[model samples]
Target chain A: MPTITVDGRRLEVPEGSTLLQALDELGLLMNGVDVPHYCWHPKLSVDGSCRLCQVEIEGVPKLQIACDTPVADGMVVHTTSERVQRAREGVMELLLVNHPLDCPICDQAGECKLQDYAVDYGLDHARTREPRRPGRKRVELGPTIVFDEERCILCRRCVRFCREVPETGELVVENRGDRSRITTFPGTPLDNPYSMNVADVCPVGALTTRDFRFKVRVWDLDEVPGLCTGCSKGCNVHVGVARGAVQRYTPRRNDQVNETWICDEGRLSYREIGAPDRITRPAVRDAEGRMQPVSIARAIERAAERIRAAVLREGPAVVAALASPHATNEDLTELRRLLDGIGTATSGAAVVEGEPDGLLLQAERAGNARGARDLGFGDPGLVFEKIRGGGVRVLLVMGRDLLAEPFLGGTDPLASLDAVILLDTHRSALEQVADVVIPGRMLAEKGGSMTNHAGLVQRVPAALEPAFDAHAEGAVLARLRAALELVLPARSEGAA
Target chain B: MVSTLVAQAPEATVLSDELRAAIDREIARFPEPRGALLAALRLVQDELGCIAPPTARAVAEIFGLHPAEVLEVLSFYNLFHTEPQGRHEVRVCTNLACSLRGARTLLRELEEHLGIRAGQTTPDGRVTLGHEECLGACGYAPMLRIGDRYHEELDGPAARALVDGLP
Candidate 1:
């Protein structure tokens, strides 16, 4: 351990720690002193190119870049000294010399590092009367990314990220000096699986995601920590909401799952959260054989009544529950409780399994398949055969859209049921045939825990209200259980 | 419900056989294929006069590196050109010592004589005039390099003669 004094506060940091890391450990980043930086990311290799993290050290002849200087025993570093501030200001001046002043029209204006540092470390006005360098604007780096050359300070964070993290070196610095800019090799644009992450790591408005370029400003959007339900990988994410709409989904840093990155699939998967076709209210078929929106209480009462009548007439074996693996553990557990009370067999929860890409994407496309299986939703292969054989009467389908899935192999198996109760968030083709529908919440509109494929149970919080007065799956299930006078068994302590 | 579309894989046979063989030989000499990048690029540039974006991509595939990495290395150096160069290259020194000794006047004369400014090649692709910081011959003052050889102590007429004599 090396004992160091930053400003006037003394602290002991581990050996081999850089002065930047030591300051970070001392909580001095946002407290009293701030070291401005561009190329020095906590997850990336230190390039020491930005020259913005310079600090004065006692007994040292010159100021040193805190990111590259290793902590030495008895070292005294001053991050807020007048000399250090002047050197930092000088670096800030040079960085802004060629950088475009279009923050008002830039997408990353509110969250830009250059804008943040300019408030404290920047010179009030430019000293030179020379014109700013004009550059190629809105260059499509790939399908999902746009590059603005004039805004780039050449931090190389995106370059290092491509080489070191995803290891797809598609992006490169082309040319030299002032003419230098980031570009992809001819015919091979930055089309990697993790290419959008470049926009997230860019400190300025140089790189921006095409989907979110002019959608909403960062400050106007509300960032809510959430989990990606794209697959069993459960990559941690932040839900960006504005005006009761999902603007974007950015990866939240979680070292155990996705470390500062969510795959392109997960990142762009936020499009379906508040889609136009989302199921917003409870509906049931009227006497004219057409489905019409109804009250939640009436829909739940009719569903329970139909299920009870089917059980009494055809026996419990004819009424099967087909829940989805996409349901949260709490939702699934409540679903199992209701099914047990009715004395019927469950078709079991299973989702379409895709091959894992060996990165963050999992083979199981279901977000909570592990939790559903842990809640005793076993193999549904046998139940599907029984349903196709016309032995089942009343079927309650939870999140999965059977008519949409090719799993039934061109056969409309759910069509044979006399009464079908579909509880889902999105409107699928099956809604045309189902007898009753309950508008359930999407994962983004619910607060529950899900077990990943690795058996890691993580909390998924509600970022926004349910669409069209849709209730959370848990709340909906709990209400249905209450209507049926079914009591859930108490969960044991520390149980999954 | 977002779609996951995978990018098409780069073609397997983008490089010429001779270039591939040369890159393979360079790779065999180094412990890691990446260690041969600079040498392989240099060899390609020497044969083609410049490395285009497609050529850089082919070289990157050969070395199992990102074309961006190859481009980063290629762009950092002034010697490497990404476009076609003139048949005969001329570099005029313009460092502090050379500039103080009227190197700027010599460059202006050469530009007027060739009818093309610095960084531009002659219309017929016979010669290219470029200004470099220093050719490591600052003592020579107003000097120029023709291809790889340096010509020191050159007046405006002498430099014009050197360009005029180029075949």
Candidate 2:
């Protein structure tokens, strides 16, 4: 272990650790003691080209880059000295020489590091009156990202990320000196699954997400901790919500899961959560056999009445419930308890399978399929057979649509059921045939815990209220359980 | 407002057998195949006059490396040219020491004699003129390196005579 003092506070770090790592271990990086930097990402390799992490050592005459300099025993460092401050201000001036002042319309303005440091380091005004060199304004790098050449400071964080982490090596720094810019080869576009992560790593407003461009500003939105429901990988993310709708999903740091990088599919999957075609209110079958909007209390009463009548006519074996792997553990647990109370414990979970890219994505597209299995849900293959064989007359669908899967051969299973009750956030193919449709909250609006494929339990909090009159699956299930107790007092008493 | 440099198509292979064998021999000298990229690129440029995008792509494919990585290395160093080369390339030293010794005047004289700017080649495809920061030849002040040979202590008339003498 080597002991080094940062501004008179001494600490010991593991041998061969750089000074930047020591500052991070001492909790002086990006908080408490601020060292301005652009190219020094903890997850990426050391690129000392930015020259912003310069710090003055006790004995060394020149300022050393804290990212590349290894800590020595009995070394004294001063990061806030007058010399260090002057060096950082000089570097900031050079970086801003070619960078544009389009912060008002730039999507990364609010959360951009260069904007924050410009205000922090007192370089908010330009010293040179020379006209800034102009370059390309908006270059579509790929399907997910857009590149702005004029606003780039050329820190090369995105280039390093492609070459180091994902190792795709598609992005490169072309031209030399003042004409240098980040670009891909002519034919090879930046089409990797992890390409959008470059937007997150950019310190300036150079690279921005195409989906989130001009949608909403970061200051107006509230970032709430959430998980991406795209797959069983359970990548941690921050849901940016504004005005009761989700705007975007950005990755959060979780070394055990995604490690500060999320796939482009997971980031864009929030579109389904805030899509305009979502089922916003509960609906029930009316006199003309059309689904009409109804109050929550009325919808639950009608569903309970039909379920109890089916149980009385054909035994509990005819009534079955199908749970979705997308639901949280608490939601699935409540659904299982309700089905057991009604004497139809033949319920299983729905699983969607695809090819895993061997990176962040998993083959099982459901977020909580493992959670469903842990709660003793039956296999999806067996449940599909029970529905097709007509063994189940009355069915409760929780957060899944059976008609959406191609294994059913384009057949609508809800057409054969006597009464079909559905609980989903989005409008599905089975909506026309369902006897009762109840709008439920998506993953961004849920307040519960979900177990990932590795059995790691993480909390997913509600960022905003449900889109319309919708409620969480757990909340709706609890309300339905209360409504059923009144209709079937004898069966409820035995289960209780 | 977007601009991109055209990379050569990966499907094209423009290297001859002799050049490919030379590249393979250089690559076999190092434990890591990528360590011989500079030498392999030099071999291609020496035989083909310049390392075009297609030639770089072929070399990258032979070494099992990404073409972009090879292009990055090609564009980074000033020694390697990624475009078609002139029959004769002239680089004039223009650092502080050489400039003080009247190297800039010599460069201007050579550009005027060749009927082209510093970075442009002649219309007759005879000579290309370029200015370099330093060639580590301060002892040989007012120096110009033509094709691999350096001419020292040159005046305006001498610099013109040197370019006019090139066939």
Question: How many clashes in each candidate?
Answer: 0, 0
| DockQ of each model vs. true complex | 0.41, 0.30
* Local error of candidate 1 at residue A445 (angstroms): 1.8
Number of the top lDDT candidate: 2
RMSD of each: 4.3, 3.9
Q: How accurate is candidate 1 locally (lDDT)?
A: 0.83
lDDT of 2 by residue, A323-422 (tens): 8888999999889878877777778876777887777888888888888889987476677788889898888887653555634534476588898888
Question: What are the iRMS values of all candidates?
Answer: 6.4, 10.5
lDDT of 2 by residue, B1-167 (tens): 01122233477567899998998999899999999999999999999888877777788888876678888888888889987768999999999889999998888888878889998999888898999888888988889889999988888888888888999
Cα lDDT over the full model 2: 0.84
What DockQ does model 2 achieve?
0.30
Top-scoring candidate (DockQ): 1
Report how far residue A156 has shifted in candidate 1, in Å.
0.7
Off by over 4 Å in 2: A1-3, A10-12, A25-28, A56-62, A72-75, A124-134, A404-407, A489-496, B1-9, B96-114, B136-143, B152-161
Weakest 10 consecutive residues of candidate 1 chain A by summed lDDT: A487-496
